[model samples]
Target chain A: MAAVKLLNCFVSPFGNRVRIALAKKGVEYEETAENMVTKGPLLLSSNPVHAKVPVLLVDGKAVCESLVILEFIDEAFAGTGAQLLPADAYARANARFWAAYVDAKMPECAGKIWKVPKGAPAVEEGKKEMVGVFKTLEGELGEKPYFGGEALGYADVALVTFTPWFLTYERLAGFSIAEECPKLTAWAARCVGENECVAKSLPDAEAVYQFVGGMRKHFGLE
Target chain B: MAAVKLLNCFVSPFGNRVRIALAKKGVEYEETAENMVTKGPLLLSSNPVHAKVPVLLVDGKAVCESLVILEFIDEAFAGTGAQLLPADAYARANARFWAAYVDAKMPECAGKIWKVPKGAPAVEEGKKEMVGVFKTLEGELGEKPYFGGEALGYADVALVTFTPWFLTYERLAGFSIAEECPKLTAWAARCVGENECVAKSLPDAEAVYQFVGGMRKHFGLE
Candidate 1:
């Protein structure tokens, strides 16, 4: 068997995603957590294009990008514990579409959600944008228990990691996600509460919010 | 056999990418050219999430996003023609990584590579960023005849469409891409010069430059 390893940051949503993917697939691998503040040589060398984690190494062949890594896990471990993506071609495309959405919208929303210093940009626009994105997601998730129908598949796996940031996402954006997207909120709760892999893989949302708060203060935003 | 159709814009790099992928795959499809400025109802209804062109309809099932469309073509039309993606798992992941890079970087670079009035954001930073992106790409290309090693594949399809905008990319950025990255420039020339699919699909660079000049004038950027 090829030795599998993961280079990651404990708090990174992308990194945690790789964790959830591997845990969900029941792929056993060694973990090397990097200091995201000053990314180590291995992470930098492994992913020179982006120079960010999480990177998965299968027998030291590095694969970067969370979405790419997720696809890699599905392909590399074809007959593992569970298949992450759906079997139907159209459903796979739909899954890819939402996965792309999560990557594109989540980070920018998270970055803009922080309370910044005066003279810095106002957060209202960011808040409004986040609300719109969530609503769109809600519309897509309409009446389905999960984005992948009945199972927590690729689309679900792609997004569920963001629950740890939902508190910060809502608080800094000055809105309640549940009020705007109750089904999505409930879906999020269910993913973390009902799914053991997601539950164990995700960090606490409150802790993440507090950590971000401290960073804001350190940068003199508070 | 499923009916295939492509919704596209003549000058869009992404739209052209879908065209190239299909041509390379030898998959015959009818085309509906959309007015990019006033996108029609079909485009809107087909891709509500993005509402962009290059939506491939295989038997009326809409698949949006150029990369997603490309993958759909490879899977849905497997064994019909040349496979655009490599057979190897790692190679497929690498192709996807660069495809993502082209999508993430090219549009921003092209948008910022326009001559704008003062107090409008400066173009220098965008130019520098584009140069860096090009250099990274050049290094990746190395001595390969194409990004796919010997043929025009996914990564090639992803980026080669940008050639029509190359003159404009160089013109506004105030750097000759040929001078900055000769191998990449030569590779670009070779792809369009040698590949029938790429050659027929791409618009003329000089004409695109002149058309963009008219648009700039319309926007009163002069």
Candidate 2:
């Protein structure tokens, strides 16, 4: 077997996505925690273009980007635990569709709920935008137990990865995602409660909220 | 064999990307030209999240997003004429890195070069911003004959997809990419001249320039 290793930071939701995948797949691997604050030379050499983390090194080959890393992990460990994706072509495309949707749209919405200054115009606009996004997810869920149906597939993993951020943002923005998106809210709660892999990988809700709060203070927005 | 269908528009660079990919792979598919001004129900229902076109439907299943569809085509038809990506994990990640970089950065740069009002402050700022992005691409390219080196890959495809727009922008903006980033300019020339798929897929230089002129007039900026 090729030696598997993961380089990550604790706070990045993208990093957390890969960590959960590793744990969910029951794949044993070495890990190196990178200090994103002052990224080192080795890190720069490994990923020259972006130089960001959540880099998965498999047998000395480095793969950057969380979505790409997730695909690599699924392909590398084909028959481990639960199948991260469906085997069917169209089903796999739909799973990827949601994953891309989350990566492209939801993350930006989460950013709005996080970094925007309190009472800033962006904050209000972001709030409206995020609400709209959450409502769409609610419609997609539409009483289904999960985004990709009963079993938690790739889409669930993508959404669940960032759902924790909602709690943090809710405290800061003085609003709740649950109140706006009930089906999505219930689905998120179920994910946190049931997925041990995801549960272990996430930081405490209060800790995350405090972290965002500290960031706001540092930027003189609080 | 599954039926392959592409829903696209004539001047949309994104839609052109999928068309290029399909042609490069030597896969036959039916084409449906969509009107972006007033999107129809087929385009809307096919991609409800972002009712955009350039959707590739394989066996009646819609795969939206040009890059995502490109990956699907590569994966589904692995042994076709040209592999859109590298098979190795690291190489594939690198390919994806540049593709993402182009997707994130190019539109803004192109917008500045095309959409910015002729004499506005924003136009001047857009020009500066475009020069900066080009310099970055030039530095990355260095002395490599191609972005992917040896053969054209996803990174090359990403840039090549926008080749028509670059020329159009040059004419409309009254500036030349060749002067700003000589290497990238030369790289593009090599791409369009040598690559059969790209050469056949793109419209002539004058046609693209006219397209940009039409877009500018449509937006009341020209």
Name the best candidate (by lDDT). 1
Candidate 2 per-residue lDDT over residues A1-222, each given as its tens digit: 678778877667888888889999988788777865678776787777678888887777788888878877777676788877887766677788788878888777767767777777666667788888778778878888887677777888877877667777677567877778877888988887878987888777777777777777877777
Model 2: per-residue Cα lDDT at residue B147: 80
Please write out the lDDT profile of model 1 over residues A104-143, one tens digit for every residue. 8877766676756533465777777777888898899999
The per-prediction tally of clashing pairs is 0, 0
lDDT of 2 at A122: 69
Clashing pairs for predicted structure model 2, backbone only? none
Q: What is the DockQ of candidate 2?
A: 0.53
- Candidate 2 ranges beyond 4 A from true positions: A1-5, A29-38, A79-81, B138-145
TM per candidate comes to 0.95, 0.91
| Tens digits of lDDT, candidate 1, B1-222 | 779889998888999999888888787889999966688898999998888998988888899988988888888788889898888889999999999999889888777777564225567777778888888999999989999999888999999999888888777767788888888889899998898889888988888888788778877886
- Report the error of model 1 at residue A160, Å: 1.0
Query: Per-residue CA lDDT of candidate 2, range B11-117, in tens?
Result: 77788888888888999999998876788788888888898978998887889988888888887877887798877756676777778788878887677667777
